[model samples]
Target: MDTEDTTGDLITRTGFHFHIRHAEPEDEAIVADFFKHVTPEDVRFRFLSGMKSVSHERLVEMTSSSDARRVNFLAFSPNETLLAAAMLAVGKDPQRGEVALTIRDDYKHQGISWEMLAHICRYAERHNFKSIESIESRENHAAIELERDMAFRAYTDKDDPTIVVLRRDFRP
Candidate 1:
């Protein structure tokens, strides 16, 4: 049986609602669409490098890999449409971790990102991780604010201009 981490319910904030669930094989298509909308430009902004697309095979590997270092999750709307996604990777230290979150373009500024991050943070905390980090584009102030509100320390290097790292301590 698939064991659930800490984030096993619907998270509601403001006027929006989303649930975090383990992504299954049946979700491949919507997940692919999520990545498609994620786009080369979006990837470049998030990664600070151009990426055309993430392959389906790579996603499958990320979800089921025995490494257990990473796990995939989907944020679905009340109507069951995907609104956002997050992949949390547990590092070798167990106390170190990283996360990536994406919101559907059509649903921007609808509180989807906030709910997703909250769930990710809660999940990280329950796992005994010391911190969870986010790498984002310097221009994405909205994301920066979200991270800040979640109590993360954010850094953007002038030399590296494009990527900002946001770190939130998970250990209490």
Candidate 2:
């Protein structure tokens, strides 16, 4: 099903109009191509490692999941060009979920990330999750600040000093 905002507005920014929908198995290749367009730093932040390339297995893990706990969302331009991707992985505890997002390098600073993140949070809430969490690298200042602006509390990961955990509670 195609997901739309409450107002039925297509996400648009900087002259780009996008359709956001839940990703399917066929989108594995599309996701791979999207990753190829991102910067190396983005890859590191997404995978938490400085890998030279995203492996097929990893792409499969992201796009084709039989597990109901995971959901991947993809944003496409009017011409169907992949613009960004976000993954929501709910833990065994139904009350919480982890989210990760990456935007095309060329789409950065255009509010796509912000819109995608808001959509993810709404998705989590609709799924009855009380909170959402994101693990971000300390060096990713833009994302860190974005999360902060979104009201997600940031704290250093005890085991990984290089990582910061951001969490936002949806419950009152």
Candidate 3:
């Protein structure tokens, strides 16, 4: 059962199914295309920026895997349509990692975000990160509630009043 959960790239939960894989540089084009389908508001919420569109530089950064401490995962529907993308990046503090995820607006509320986030949390745990955190825009109620439902505690970011840090700490 454990192996089944860890090894398979396919996930089916709550009557929804999607394939997930570690991202690669070659995926830039598809990711860019996927973002084009995402709503501007969703993009702002995901990136915490007001950019009307995702830039080529940002796409390249998201698709690249040169950083050993970071891993980005991409999700696709059974028919090969991109559904979502998630990132887990561990910084100098090895015990803590930051997570960011976004789902195509059309796919929102179908449990894709929840499933993708849960998977990223599991990855962080396995990697020995004592805690996982995400910085979310204060206006992003949907994401804040989702993270809270997953046992993440939300707190205002000290340096930025416009954002909140949602954190889930692992038990030693």
Candidate 4:
């Protein structure tokens, strides 16, 4: 599949292939629908809140934003089913960006998270970010381990004892 289109890019993993692309404002409906399949626990993990449902306003902001420093990526299965979503928010500090990743409820353990995080790392690097960080709840062992495996160092958040900051400083 061609990787040059604005619609999406087809990426092949070890045993499967999927399409990933930047989200557009028109994707608000689908992006909102994508949240329906995300587990409640994951929703909390993703938003760091007890949100049972993603608000329409939040979805709108995510899809409608034209900010150059903020990007949201969506991953879809070969059959065009949305599988995962990721966000990279670059703050004033050009040296770092904060990232978040979420997968559909039934798609866990499929390596999508790893691919998404790796892709985000490369994306951050290309944009001149020297590091990327993810704030994770301490209870989220799987995500913490995944980040550690990717060479991200875990530091106790200076302000939050209930969470840790996983940061990966890219090599210059």
Which structure among the candidates has the greatest TM-score? 3
Clashes of each: 0, 0, 0, 0
Model 1 Cα lDDT, one tens digit per residue, 1-172: 1227634556455666667786666777787777766656666655466668767786675355244677777888778887777778866677878888777778887777777778777777777779988888887788889889989998776767667889998666
Which candidate, 1 or 4, would have the higher TM-score against the true structure? 4
Per-residue lDDT tens digits for candidate 3, residues 1-172, read: 0122332354545688888877789999999999988998889988988898889998888887776777778899989898998888878887898899988888877888888888878877776779999999999899999999999999888899999999999975
User: What C-alpha lDDT values do all the predictions have?
Assistant: 0.73, 0.83, 0.83, 0.82
TM-score of candidate 4 versus the correct structure, residues matched by position:
0.91
Off by over 4 Å in 3: 1-7, 10-13
Candidate with better TM-score, 1 vs 2:
2
Best-to-worst order by lDDT is 3, 2, 4, 1
RMSD of each: 2.8, 2.7, 3.2, 3.3
RMSD of 2: 2.7
Clashing pairs in 3: none
Q: Is candidate 3 or 4 superior in TM-score?
A: 3
The candidate that wins on lDDT is 3
Task: Indicate the TM-score of model 1.
Answer: 0.83
Residue 70 CA displacement from its true place in model 3, Å: 1.1
lDDT per residue as tens, model 4, 1-172: 1112324454435555677887878998888999999989899999999988999888876675476677888898988788888888878886788999889988888778887788778777766679999999998999999999999999998899989999999875
Give the Å error, residue 107, model 1: 0.9
